[model samples]
Target: MSTLTVILLSIISLMYSCKDNNTAQSEDIKEIKSSEATTQLSPNTTTTKDTISIDKSTKTNTFTSSPLDLLKQNEKAIVTLFQEASPSVVFITTSVYQRDYWSRNVYEIPRGTGSGFIWDEDGHVVTNYHVIKDASKAEITLSDHSTWQAELVGVAKEKDIAVLKIDAPKEKLKAIKKGSSNNLIVGQFVMAIGNPYGLDHTLTTGVISALGREIQSQARIPIRDIIQTDAAINPGNSGGPLLNSSGELIGVNSAIYSPSGASSGIGFAIPVDVVKWVVNDILKYGEVRRPVIGVSMVAENYTKGFGIEKGALISSIFPDSPASKSGLQGMTNSRLGDVIVSLDDKEIKNNTDLILALEKYKPGDKVKLTVLRNNKEMEIDLTLGSSN
Candidate 1:
């Protein structure tokens, strides 16, 4: 061959070798990227990773778990809660007897239905007073679908709490675990299990929207220190237990703020603090024992008309009782009397204050009181008496 032909052939061979080397390097790089991306997906996945970039700002909070696995875990937790709590819940059906004018037959008429929870191993059911109120009798359906006739154990109508007892075996009764509602904060998660609208065990979830609400009881007494939640509470939900995420009983579902008488997202529950007190009292005293100071407070309007802005004015005093014997005087013909302004270290601004303060103590406990009598302030050490 010629010298120019030999030189050209060598240059062409060198160029072809470099091109092949570049292609091999490109294939090796592609294999490495494919291996790294394979860890993020399974064989059955069709999701595209290009648009699924993880934001670095949320790196600390980002989940490194498989979505399906996380979903399964959450579903397991919810199922466990329902299974653990449903045993403590019961369905209450109330009935009354009505006489037919035409038939002269006393037929059992169904009044309403509500929910309750077992309170103790003795098959004691705790529910709202208005639920079993005025009903001739009630039938309790246990979690096992066993029906039992319930007998009234005791009731606190002022607080709208009632207890019923069934003759079931201890193995059939599952008492709920109690939790505190006093330290609850807004936005904390809560769960409500009840028979809303008489549909068997229904579960609703929500958060504590607010706290320290007030509602009226069937006895016309004010129920204070209520916990407000967004949990759906309807008519049948009354007497059901309101629970925290841990499945502990925190409150008793009582009233709702819906104009249509349904779940309005504004539901009030009787705090467990009050429930504990009432349940203890009923189990001991057969009813709520109110501590009385033996003095009736003046009408709020009557006291306000005299330019008295604070304190509950004394209207009348039960003769020979704590207030009367303690030299406490009441309003005479001129509507002038002693005004209770404080009890111990707590301030009593109105009748509500006085009543609530009295609730903290039992009968025969000595309490110090500060009252305004005839525009003069004085302190009295009085013995608290019971209105039993």
Candidate 2:
């Protein structure tokens, strides 16, 4: 054989050997890929080399929720209070009748909404006077979602309080327990339950921010001895109860001092002490039965015109009454009469002050009055008379 022929034979053998090695590498790669694909396709499959194993019994879809801790002492107390006192709270809705100009048909339109509470088992409901003011009809809804038509019983416009009667069963009516507001102190915790924004039975917690605060009623009368709180009182919270820690009503949530018409922490309530008498008088007389001093005081504007800026100026006295018998003089064409400066040592600043002062007493109750006559201060003793 020739040398060139021997070299050609060697090159062909090398090419065949290289092709066999490439085929072996491709088969090995296919086997390795098949194993990996099987591992991914079957999550339950296990491999000792990579040490990857998934238990079929283990569930990643099911969630195990953690337990919640128990409530704290104060939190539990508030919860209990809300549970007990909420039954007495009620939701109030008012409507006004409007006649369409074209159709000449009358229809009841929703006027507003507010909060209220049961006053007695006979279905007497208590709320703010402004809540039902100008309303032709009112309705009361109990905590159980039962609603009833409410009749207007009476209203103390000066105090911004009103009373309504419902025909609900005595079993459904839960009257709130009364608490004294005179003993309330600032920083004392209080809770307010109301239907804010038409949401029924909403609760808010806060403290009494101040005592003896004054607020004006819808009648433009100054409501004195008011309780100021930091509770979140809104427009619908008017007529709701302000309860103390014991779940007794200490005041009636009435107003908020906010420019945005929402709660800005400063809220006012009508003191329960004043509410007690006002409600009682309404139940009996259909109006507040305030004591009469048998004397007419000059309006604040007129008093200011006379240069009397800080006291109630007496305009006239009724004959054979408390003022006349006590020799309380009134304004004369010649000179000024007595300007009441104080009542029972309480300073009187205007006619409203004197009127509110007189409300603190009853008929035949003796009171001492300090008056300014001829620029000289003198004291007078008189017995109050009945307005009736």
Candidate 3:
């Protein structure tokens, strides 16, 4: 209990006091973080720092949301897009008149109803070709309830898209804000705005269910890179706008993979890229000029092995086709044919490879094709042909 002992005791007390202060500061920081976390704004809800209310009606307590909140915050953006695009969207109805064979009387039948959007102020409206198939008359009803008789401008059966024109005021045209479908990602929020079941301007929310979906159009040809969504799309929703969170038109609601004729939560849309291509062609050439190879072939199964064994077996090549000129052998034995093994330098695994490769070129573009003939690989160059 001398001066040195007293000084040592004082140092121990100061150390203990500092440790306690540090512990208190740590607890305060933790408390602040917890408060901040809870105070985060819920999406689609108008929550402020001064007044935060949790609605038990729409949201459950177990669901602490981050992306959900983001979706809610984007609800305004979805609504605005729908509202702005709604005016440009039109409800298309078709009428077919047929004569009753037994009664010898002609009757007007309501063919169908679908949705479409204004392409430009020139009165052109774009929609699904199936929406007006074999109809004797077509009509378009705007968001303002104004109805006009529409004339078919052009139709692209391959893309299942059609363009029509109506004699309406230029000022009434409201084209949707176009967006890139390539930028879409799976699980991102999307909204479908259309006339579902003839109910005009209906809005449904969903997320991108998948990408690069391939579906057969009304013409029974494969349409590629279709956007798949869980949005509640129905019969009348065809040709309507499928919008992104920013309210831009990313796709055109085209088909549904439902057996019930109603929404099974699986809907397909024509990607904006295809729509853009169709639109540009319809506006310029009044038709889609698809490229063709002018050759018929069967899909050769290749799971067993490679070589002439299986690939795209040439069935019949047109007399003046590029394939015929390139010396690509066709099936003369009715069962066996030369198999396409590669294009340029890329290996062709199946017919899909050849299909995808041809998409990159137009008519008259020469492409190198490697073929397997008599168990030996051979090369040939063929110029593409126009499907027109």
Which candidate has the top score in lDDT? 2
Q: Clashes in model 2: which pairs?
A: none
For all predicted structures, in order, the TM-scores are 0.81, 0.79, 0.72
The whole-model lDDT of each prediction reads 0.89, 0.92, 0.83
Best by TM-score: 1
lDDT of 2 by residue, 122-224 (tens): 9999999999999999999999999999999999999999999999889998999999987899999999999999999999999999998889988888898
Q: Is candidate 1 or candidate 2 better by lDDT?
A: 2
1-388 in candidate 3: lDDT tens per residue? 8999999999999999999999999999998986766656454345555876766565535466699788987676776767776787889999999999999999999999999998788899889999998999999999889999999889988789999999998877787778898778999999888898889999899999999999887776678999999999998999898988777888889999888888999999999987987888788887876566667777455434434444677767888877778777776754456788887788877666676567667778888888887777888888888766
Put down candidate 1 lDDT per residue, 1-388, tens digits, no spaces: 9999999999999999999999999999998988777655434333364644443444343257799999999778877888899899999999999999999999999999999999999888999999999999999999899999999999988899999999999999999999997789999988899998889799988899999889998977789889999988888999999998789999999999988987889999999988998998888888888888998877676778977899988888998799988998887776588888999979988887788788889899999999887788899999988887
lDDT value for model 1:
0.89
Per model, state how many residue pairs clash.
0, 0, 2
Q: TM-score for model 3?
A: 0.72
- A best-first ranking of the candidates according to their lDDT comes to 2, 1, 3
